[model samples]
Target: MTDASGRIALLRATIVVVAAGGLRALTYRAVAAEAGVSHGLVRHHFGTRDQLVAEAMEFAIDESLRGSNMLEQGLTASEFAAGIESLADRESALQSFQYELLLESRRRPELTPLAERHYGAYREAIERQLGRLGVADPALVDLIWFALDGLVFTQLVAPADPAPALARIRSLVESAAA
Candidate 1:
């Protein structure tokens, strides 16, 4: 395959794998079967399962980044609530992919460091926002982090809407600040 064809192939395979959800032990054969391509083609682009997963996870992250423009500006209290809403939408697309990556990382310790790095960037962004607000409570910041994770999980699992949760968090943060 040409370079463009190879990238399109991987992109299609990634979409299938993500839609399949939590395919922890998925092989190149599985991906190739889904993509209707030869197994060798899958292996050609992603040499190992880890490499495939990494690329898939990166694809999900890139999708998540699509809606983060609102956060580029310094987030005020209300703006932060909107950011959470945007992020919840983003997380919904990639939650299963994230879950599988984390589970797979247990056996493949090499991937653990990459996970940490991804999570560290998440924490740092939150910390930077808190710093902008002049909040000194590391404990509170941790609570917000936990709350955000819970929000993502809730949005993923429950049938309820996220607007109420987002509103409640906004109120909580505003009240705490006041």
Candidate 2:
């Protein structure tokens, strides 16, 4: 793999490693084994473990955004969180990786800013979609983000059908718009 692709691969491997075993399991050797490369390759790309975590978190955020409709403009209530279950199911590890980062930030002061920034980006995307639905209330937007966040987390821990809960959220948004 080229430098860019190799770096991306390592980042993905990092996500998988952290997702499965949390921050304690994030070692260069583990990531290298996951990516089928040498530990030196992981070290060469990210000089420190902190750098690896930060970069991997960024890559995970990009993946989450690409898989979500939160950033899309002009989406209807019915379209909100459509296929969210499948997306969550398919990207379970990716979602878990982000959650791990969120939890780790509480323990590591340095990671707090990065976690907040990345999480704010998701909240903002959801806010934009809410705006398109004619619900511009900041509190309501925050509530929606929380609900979506909760749903995603619940699904991660114990797989459940999210359709009904999402339907309720959609109805609430539609009523708020009305």
Candidate 3:
């Protein structure tokens, strides 16, 4: 493989390992095994486990955000909910890995800033959406975001059909708009 392709393969492998095993459980050998590369190659690319975790976390967040297309114009609550549901269906481990890193950040101060920055992007997107809907308060953004987060978490843990819950959330948001 070319250098770029090799790097891409390693990065993909890193994401799978971290998503499947969490940051604490990640190992160079595991990443190599997932990537079909050597452990030395994994270490050469990432240097350390922390670097690997940071890159993988960032990649996961970027990929999820990209898949959601949340910044597109004329977004609706139902559409947003559908995006969430699609994420749950397609990349369940993405959310779990993100939450795992977030919780783990509480114990690792160095990770706090990265987690906050990643989460801030989601918050900012929601805030923009709420703002477009004529809701200006930051608190309301927080509330709406928390509601969405709760839905995602519950879906992850309990594995339920999210349509009804998402509909209820859309109703509540719409009612609040009135």
Candidate 4:
């Protein structure tokens, strides 16, 4: 396969690994079986279980940012807020998987650096967008992040309709920017 194909295959495998949540703790054999790829292929690309987990997490965050690229495209404040709300709604599974990875990262400090890197990338993206809109309130961003984290937690546990909560959050963000 070409390099692009290999990268795509690895990313697809990472998606499966993220979705499998606790199965990653079992074995690469299990993940390969679930991803419908050979165990050798999984090992060849990742080298070790810790590397695989970290790459899986990074892939997830990249996929999510790609899914929510409106901010990069120069959306208005309200539009960015709405886009984020919609992205959260659409990427709820990815967010839940991230929380699972967070739990794993606690036990596997090797993964923490990668996790922190992905999170910092996300925060930087948000900060860049806010700066473009002349919204320099770090406290507001922190509050939004706190609220977003709480919403993700609640959604993972109870699986509510996110629209109402998201609209409220968007309104709050918009108000802050006003």
Candidate 5:
């Protein structure tokens, strides 16, 4: 593999390890083993476990957002809701990994800023989506985003079918515009 491909592969492996094991259990050797590369490769790429964990966390957030279509434009309500379900289905450990990092931040103050910044992306995306739907009130974005978040969180723990709740949210947004 080329340098870029190799780097991507390594990063992907790091994300899997971090997602499966959490930051507390992460080690360079473990990442390397998971990636099928040498431990020195992981060390050379990331320099330290802290750096690896940080990058992995960022990667997870970005991947989750991308997979969920949170950054896409002109999404219908069904599309948006389907995106949420797809994320939960495809990236099963993603939410758990995110929550793990969030809780870990309490003990590792240095991680707090990273966690906040990562979540800010989600909020910004929700705000943009609301804006696209012609919802003028900023507070509405918060309420809708939190409600959607609650739906996603509950789905993660209970594994429910999301179509009904999603349709209701869609109706709510439509009614708000009407």
Candidate 6:
């Protein structure tokens, strides 16, 4: 594999390892095995475990935002988070990896910045969406974000059909603009 692709593969492998077995399960050997590469390659790419975990977290956050259409502009409230279910289903491991990292930050103080960045991305995206819909209040945006956050968290932890709840959220969002 090329250098860039190989590195991203390692990042993805890191996500899967953490998702399946949490942070403790992550090691150069584990990521190497998951990526089908040598442990030395994993080390060469990331240099340290902290770097590996941080890069993986950032990658997952970007990918999750892109896939969920959360950062895309011009979407109405009904259109916001339209493909969330599919994104969640397809990228459950990625989602779990992020949650693992977020929770891990509680124990490992060094991870706080990345954890904050992760949430900040979601908040900014929500702000943009709400802004387009003429809902400019930060407090209202935060409330909506919390509700949406809880919705996704519940779906991930419990595995449920989220269509009804999602539809309700969209309805509320649309009416909130009126």
* C-alpha positional error of residue 85 in candidate 4 after TM-score superposition, expressed in Å: 1.7
Query: Cα lDDT of model 2 overall?
Result: 0.84
**What C-alpha lDDT does candidate 5 achieve relative to the native structure?**
0.74
**Local accuracy of candidate 3 as per-residue lDDT tens digits, 1-178:** 9887887787777767766777766788988899898899988887988887787787777777776756666866555544544356667777777877888899999999779977798788877766666668788678767877777777777877778876766675566555
Q: What ranges in model 1 sit over 4 Å off?
A: 1-12, 18-21, 33-38, 69-71, 86-91, 175-178
Q: What stretches of model 2 exceed 4 Å from their correct place?
A: 81-87
- On residues 1-178, what C-alpha lDDT tens digit does candidate 1 reach at each position? 7867775667556656764656654777777877778888887788887678777776665555445532355667666655655255655546656655666678889878657755665566666666666666777777766776677766666746777776776676665555
Which wins on lDDT, candidate 1 or candidate 3? 3
lDDT of 1: 0.65
TM-score of candidate 3 on Cα atoms, chains taken together: 0.83
Which scores greater on lDDT, model 3 or model 4?
Answer: 3
TM-score computed on alpha carbons, candidate 4: 0.84
Please tell me which model should have the higher TM-score, number 1 or number 2: 2
Q: What is the lDDT of residue 56 in candidate 3?
A: 75
Candidate 6 stretches greater than 4 Å from native:
81-87
In Å, residue 20's CA in model 1 sits off its true spot by 2.0
Q: Residue 140: error of model 3 in Å?
A: 2.5
Which number leads on TM-score? 6
Candidate 5 regions off by >4 Å? 76-86
Q: What local distance difference test score does each model get?
A: 0.65, 0.84, 0.74, 0.70, 0.74, 0.84
RMSD of each: 3.5, 1.8, 2.5, 2.3, 2.2, 1.7
lDDT of 5 at 121: 76
All candidates in order of TM-score, best leading: 6, 2, 5, 4, 3, 1
